[model samples]
Target chain A: MKTKSTIAIIGSTGNMGSAIAKSLAKGSNRLLLFGREDTKLQTLKNDIHTLNSGADVEAIGCPKDASWEADIVILAVPYAAEAAVAEEIRPYVTQKIVISIANPMNETFDGMVTPADSSAAQELQKLLPDAQVVKAFNTTYAANFAEPVIAGVPADAYVAGDDEKAVQTVTELVQSMGLNPVVAGGLAVSHTLEHMQLLLIQLTVKNNYNWHAGWKILHN
Target chain B: MFSELEKNLRQHITLTTDEFDRVKRYFVPKKLRRKQFMLEASDVCTRMAFVSKGALFSYSTSEKGSINVVQFAFESWWMADLYSFFTEEPSKLYIEALEDSELLLLKADRLQPLLADVPAMETYLRILYQNAYVALQRRLEETIGLTAEQRYLRFMERDGRLLLRVPQHMIASYLGVTPETLSRIRKQVS
Candidate 1:
């Protein structure tokens, strides 16, 4: 049985956010799209409704002075904007599973990027200490998100958080997208996965390879 | 510095006094003289060593053979080329002692059982990796977005303690800047 999860994508107009909204619309009915730009939010809402007629979707502009009442909140904003978003929505996030999809890439086009002591996810976690911040979906490219499979590999998304229940919920969400969800274990493990993404990005650019390559956990 | 590392390790990984003792049995305490190579490039990183005292650095040589310092592991920190250690592949990295050092070394075969016996070690490891990943992401972002001077300022703001211990040349290497560039940035910032 597919459990209906009330979801809100904080930055729905961006490439990854829109892709997530599309994927969720196909699988689940209840979705609320939020974006700073009103036109983008309305456009995404219309697109999701058009694609999945049965999907119960709503679009809202500005999370500030807005009710963030949802089971899950997907933070799809840039890494630089994450702290502000977390602060704005902190009071509204009562008991929601917060998933950060932003990777701390350089704001400029200069090579690899991330902070020295912590990741964007960790920074978000610090800001919203109450919300269960699970790091996932940051590794995969937006172009690969719409596809059923990435390359020959079934896009294995890594989910990591301190809360077991939150992890399970996000795992199910990943599975719903027709992608495998491997629990990489806790928020700290996010570091390894993020570094792996850096490596993947380097490989992709240096080798002139497709962005389809993703990680899969092999079991004996 | 070692105490901070111990506390960080203990917070994430739980070890029974007995398990800690058992794990301690496998670790051969050894000293690394300054400039000593702990692990070399083209070698499989077979050991995960915990620093009980002093500083060490792990770095890789670029195409031009210029050494790029990736990390500096101070006292109580775990140091290794994780990719090489896990995959048993020849490392592009070289690990060396930055100062006179004492480390508790554990071989891979021994580490597996130790982690299995002490599940908290897994938690500790997860935290360690998470912290590393977070730092890497931030560094990458800084590298890309921030000006060279901004990056140096941010680095100092975050790791002021490390600035005192690690030399100017190594700091420059870690920042992906030349020593002269770092000196110039420092002068301008100061």
Candidate 2:
């Protein structure tokens, strides 16, 4: 069964967040959008309404408020911006699914900012000890979210989390967005997911993929 | 995305936009890449998918490593392991996308409410099942009682549209013949 739930996009105005909001707006889920810029949030809400008029999208002022109200919370901000956001929403996100889509790429884009022992999702989970942290959507560029299928394949969205129920929920959400959801492993697997995106960014920067390339595993 | 489904239903029964709108809400949209298995062996089918775009096929594998193609579903056609969906049992069949496909899925739980709320939908379903029953009865009769050439002719008569879309070996499997036998029969028929 398709379970409809309220999802809060904490950084709804950013590229990945807005893309996810627009994509999920097409479905039956209710969205509580929070962001740093009010004007951009309003514009995103309007665009979503244009895309799906019957969509339930609301722009909220407070991150904690949005987190408390939503069943699933997606932190779609950059790795540099997640700490402040996480601290603010920590209390509200207890026992909730908190998705971390941050890639801790260093300035040169060749390495990671996160320490060798921990990934961004792991750090976020450590910060909010009660929340279920899931790492996903960091593998592909935001453009893929608009049209997930490339050639004949849906972009693979690898999801890793400690909570089985939360992972399943995110898997269903990914499937609803028309992408293939592969369960990578537990929350510790976030390290590999982060590194995978780092390599993707490196490949795109070195090659002529034009930031449109994504991961797709071919199997017979 | 529901346009194809609406069109298929309209062919059987007439409904206003309002009624159609109500019926559409009961479905969830799902897209699958080519060769993706929507329903696999030992998995319980929770929902029935109605294809809106692309093609799919249902098949079962034997212990001898041969596949028996049972059905091919194109636009507006529905694919599900009915035994699994109805009885909540594990299925032995495999339903794979023949190409990248867009589908509208109706979960088993919603089926009853949808049918109850929309009587026209019930009528549409009944008509479809009736037609399907007749086609299956004919297929079984030909498969058991008729010769291979007769079966091929009957299959050609009914699924001529699929000839261009489906591969030859799958068609041979559906007709219960080997690839070489099917090739010889095709040459003879021509």
Candidate 3:
């Protein structure tokens, strides 16, 4: 029943970030878009407004400023850059939802970069004890974000977070993007979720699945 | 769009051009895509919006998620859940755009400052509220007293222009009748 949450998407000019922004525009939430280039973010903002003119969106150049004003913060940077961005906005994100959407793939894209025991999301959670770090969108490719339906079923957006309310908030958010949200249990489940992405990426690259593959759970 | 607002303003109170110039800053401009929700039942109505373009409708829902259509607003009309706005409670109604809409939004917190800054705005708001009250009473009377056929006839007479903009299903909801019943009534009238 929640409506109109303020969400900040850092690195919003990236593939995952822009795709999420465009689809999320259809919802009533307010979006604070931040990226390396202000002009690019503004262009992305305009595109979203084109899709839904009633969307409340602003392009912010400062990451800290955008994160400071938002209720939920989605870190869409690569795994390599996540630590720096997390620390930069650490102080401002206390009690706020910080979603990690990076799949820590190795340079060759054949394997993951994170330790076997941890994930990008878990590392983010460790960095910001005050913020609710949830892992989502890591399991799906950027292409699937625009059109969530693949194989005639809505792709499952697997979300993992320790905070139930934050998890629920993200579930609502994923639903807003016209996807199905599967609560994949506590943040520890993020390691598996990240691995799932790694496997999918490898499969797509190796077998030429065209990067349109995503997860879906079917039940009677 | 500003002309619609200006014409609406010119009817009630006199405002110097400079005064009207200052009035525009208090309101933020927003656009809603067709079928976009302006306010959902779970949201405490934080903004009262004036429709500058397009059309919108508001409705309340039962626990089972069936809607009871309440009102529709077109260009130059204002829409808000007054009870939610005043009491700061979660709204019981959902306000949605029937078409791509441009709205000038007045935030709840800005109301006092706006009235204080522009004394003429108070006169305009008073007239707006009075007319809104009169309209509400008339709507209630029609809802309770009129037969379904009479209501359909009255709607065709008064809001026939909306037929092109609003869907027949929503219009049926607004008339407090089933879609089949409305379809039968439409056939009877034709």
Candidate 4:
């Protein structure tokens, strides 16, 4: 972009978060990895540096450190922990483009646990009113994030956010990972993205398909 | 019947008159009076209903006889015990008309051929489910996460038309609140 964007990832120790971190490391961007576990964060940072030696990645122990100056922040925490995490990151959230990849799937994975009338991103946006919350990457599996390509075809990233600039920022980030970005519409559509993830999970379980299968929007 | 469905389909995908005519025959039109049950528990839900006019809803009752409204389908919306329709199992949900409603019914037997003959309809159906899946999940999350007051306010903000049409008790059930609680919330909001 205009300059090497500083990308802060909350919950970077998780599989989804780490996968996103690994994929985005290819570009000339600095990564601030936020996590509760110090050793896990250190391990992830080392792994990223090993994959791309020139990658500037640092492990941040505190959530507030992420707010210092990140151009965009990705929330990769569990759906249940979203409010707590949002509160922790609140002070630094002003004007920052926040990307949510959390799906409010129930513990049984049979269905979702969120209120049927709202979505995870909507809840997060309400909690962090100052931040621009965009929903992306929740529909695509973490396995696909490693390369964003399967069978020589690039995976698609459906992004939804109220702010056009924020959506554009995340679209570029999705592009950097070698994925195609489709602006799915305003932030309210995040509900659709989250539910789409649940449907994918159900389909995979029913068909005995592995987590690697991804969806592509085919148009004429 | 085809005109309303065509209008809804056009919002997602444009279909030529020839393709539309080919696929339209698969749907059978049906009507239900207000409070009539279209689908009952313990019966196989062999068909999915698309609301052409008026409203209907599906609900499941707890062992204690308390009901939780799972879905409400208005004009241009689809309703069925999807699991039962797909798997041919007995449905645990009850779908009843809330108003004198007309629906375009598509049986499971006809769905495959309809898709096979007009393959583009598959894409349209996918887009339809994409939107429905999202709406259902959002409603589920809101039902779980928000308070009765918050949920009622959100419903009022998003789908206030339902408030004018649906019975107060049914709306309360949908919000997972008791009728009295809904009344209190309404009073508080006003």
- Find the candidate with the highest DockQ and give its number: 3
Off by over 4 Å in 2: A1-3, B1-190
lDDT of 1 by residue, B83-128 (tens): 8888998888888889987766666656777687776677777787
What's the DockQ for every one of the candidates? Answer: 0.01, 0.01, 0.07, 0.01
Give, for candidate 3 chain B, the lowest lDDT window spanning 10 residues: B24-33
Error of 3 at A17 (Å): 0.6
- What is the iRMSD of the candidate numbered 2? 12.1
Which RMSD does model 1 reach against the true structure?
A: 24.5
How high is the lDDT of residue B99 in model 2? Answer: 87
Listed in order, each prediction's TM-score against the native is 0.51, 0.54, 0.56, 0.53
- Expressed as tens digits, the lDDT of each residue in A93-202 for candidate 2 is 65568899999888999888899989999999988776779988888688998888877678899999988878998999988898899999999999998898899888
Worst 10 residues of 4 chain A by lDDT: A62-71
Between prediction 3 and prediction 4, which has the larger TM-score?
3
- Name the fnat for model 4: 0.00
Per-residue accuracy of model 2 over B78-159 as CA lDDT, tens digit each: 8887778879988889888888887777767678989987888989878866776776788789889999988999888877
DockQ of 4: 0.01
Stretches of candidate 4 above 4 Å error?
B1-190
Docking class of 4: incorrect
- Which parts of model 3 are misplaced by more than 4 Å? A1-3, B1-190
Give the per-residue lDDT digits (tens) of candidate 1, residues A71-110.
Answer: 5789988877888889898755533568988777674434
Task: Write model 4 residue lDDT over B1-190, tens digit each, in one string.
Answer: 5678999888878788998877666665555557767788888887788998999999999999988898888898899888888788889998988898877777676789889988888998898778778987999899789888998898899889766888899899999888999999999999
- In Å, residue A147's CA in model 2 sits off its true spot by 1.0
Give one digit per residue, the lDDT tens place, for model 3 in A92-181. Answer: 675678999988889988778888899999999998876789988888788988878998988899999998878998998898788889
Query: Candidate 1, which segments miss by more than 4 Å at Cα?
Result: A1-3, A64-67, A108-114, B1-190
